[model samples]
Target: MKSSLRILAALAPLLLAACAPQQLVRHQGDAASLAQQDAREKQLAHADHWTLQGHLFVSNGQDGNGGTVTWTQNGDRYEFILRAPITGKSFRLTGGPDGAELDGLDGGPQTGPDAEALMRRVLNWDVPLGQLRAWVMGTRAAQGGVAQLSFDDNRLLSSLQQDGWDITYPAWDTTHQPPLPAKVFARKPPFMVKLSIQSWTMQ
Candidate 1:
């Protein structure tokens, strides 16, 4: 269930190989077992509104390129825009990952497949939008049957193992109303997406 995401050049093409420390956060009790408590925590941090800017990429055992995605989540409604460098030109794309609406510089009201195609035209590679948000936030979807979840000293979602996928969060600041992720790592081999939140806006 991967969709194409476009990467901006100024922020793209930086998919160089880099390794980070294998970190483990201590949080007692299985979170999945405490659905109500976990849900409470999610509601507590509560993202009434969230906006972030960063580079994103996906790999399938091939060369990957990074793209810039400016995402803003307003309550349940969201707006996601992507831009990537390809063939010495920059293409802009704006839409919602959960199928909100589409407004692109390329024109035409596009659907999911169409939007994905538009970004691929500029990024020169396919992007996985579904995974992008999950990685950026350092959390999994509420639908995911989380086997276990833990928090770090920062009270941020530190680690999660949902549906056999391992996720790690480092450096989080809830100073924002919706909370902001400093960095997130989603490792599942062949598709390890890492993100660094450059700036955050909460309202």
Candidate 2:
């Protein structure tokens, strides 16, 4: 019995050694995946000319708005249009290096120095449109440092914190190379925005 026990103890070390290789392989695979994802994000950063059709829902912890949204991007210029189905209300926001213009409000067209300021003044919603241009594309915003980041099993961005906002990607359109966000949800305390993308066109 003593000899048998000794043999079993010796075999236990071999079993543990066998598991170590698998663990190492898994760790290496994870490292490789993260490297690939980083490369993909770098590539997407340069994808400035693209269009996306999606549904957007925004809430300010009191009032909520939902609509079909179409966004077009051409270099530094962008146009975001949101149309409410039931109310037939629509808003168009266009901006570039020069400035931002918002139309289809109660008053005449509104213009401001930037889109974020204009949105807050006209819509009373504190939305980070500048950062969203990158977040919506499933990448980090170009300007700010990320506070936190989490990845899914597929090594895709699952959640991130930046500029006091917590953003999450629940689904991805893997049919596209490097995949694109299918659903993006972002919240900052009383403000929350959710986007469900239907299609994407890169130009």
Candidate 3:
């Protein structure tokens, strides 16, 4: 019995060493996946001309609005339209490098130098349109530096922290070339925006 115990003890160190190689391989695989993901993000960053139809929900701790949303983007120009069937409220935001315009509101048409400022003043909604342009496409914003990022098992973006917002991608449309986000949720304290994308059209 004493000799048998000694043999088992001697094999324990060898067994542990065998597992070390597997651990190293797993670590290497993770690194490779991250590298691939980074390359994919670079490609998506340049994808500026596309349209997406989705559902958007926004909340500011108390008041909330939910509706069907359609966003069309062409280079730096974009047109965003939202329709709330239950409330019979709707709005359209169209903008480019020159300026921005918001229509279908109480005070009639409103124009400003930027979309974010216009929406904040007219609708009282704190939305980061510039940053969101990239985020909605599953890439980090070009301006604000990202604080952290996490990936799912498929090496797709799972969650990220950037510009004071915690953004998460719960699902992806794997049918696309590089895959696109199907559901995106972003929160910053009292403000939260959730998007459920139904279709994407690339140009």
Candidate 4:
């Protein structure tokens, strides 16, 4: 029994080492892959046509609203539609070089030069549509604002801040090629928006 105890004690260190997890190492290959992904993201930034279907939740200090969102982007033009199933109300916002037009089931079309400001006044939701175009792609907006960004172990964007908004990518579509954000949350003081993307189609 004494010899058996001694043998087991001698093997403990080996057993412990075998059970330990391997240390993660970042090498040149990892750096190259990250650079390639960065280049791809930059290419996607210039994408002229794309469509996204998703569910969105928006909240302000007073109330919270949720609905389906369908956004289509074409060059400098964009069309955004939001619908609240509970109330059966829908709003459409379109913007181009001319200006921005917002229409809803409750009122006539409202026109303005800025879509973000228009949505805030019309729907009472302060949504930054221009910055969102880049943010939704897991990249920061190029408006030259101070940005703070973080990456996950996979070298994918985990969170970012720009233009007074803090955005988090809690989940992504890893099953698809060039993984895209699956769930995102953006927040500013008194306002917050959450998005769950159902489908993405790029043209």
Question: If scored against the real structure, what TM-score would every candidate get?
Answer: 0.60, 0.81, 0.82, 0.77
Minimal lDDT window, size 10, model 1: 9-18
Q: Is candidate 3 or candidate 4 better by lDDT?
A: 3
Off by over 4 Å in 3: 1-29
Q: In model 2, which range of ten residues has the least summed lDDT?
A: 11-20
TM-score of 2: 0.81
lDDT for residue 166 in candidate 1, whole number 0-100: 62
lDDT ranking from best to worst? Answer: 3, 2, 4, 1
lDDT (Cα atoms) of all candidates against the true structure: 0.50, 0.66, 0.66, 0.62
For model 2, which pairs clash? Answer: none
| Number of backbone collisions per candidate | 9, 0, 0, 0
Q: How well does candidate 2 score on lDDT at residue 188?
A: 72
Error in Å for residue 6 of model 4? 73
Tell me the deviation in Å of residue 34 in model 4: 6.0
Give the C-alpha lDDT of model 1.
0.50
Candidate 2 at 155: error in angstroms?
Answer: 1.2
What tens digits encode model 3's per-residue C-alpha lDDT throughout 23-77?
A: 1121222675678667878878779899998877665565555667788989999
User: Which of candidates 1 and 2 reaches a greater TM-score?
Assistant: 2
Candidate 2, residue 58: how far the Cα is off, in Å: 0.8
Q: 14-82, model 1: which lDDT tens digit per residue?
A: 221123335656564454534533554475445547788776554434545556656676765556555
Q: State the displacement of the C-alpha of residue 105, model 4, in Å, after optimal TM-score superposition.
A: 4.9
Query: Between 1 and 2, whose lDDT is larger?
Result: 2
lDDT of 3: 0.66
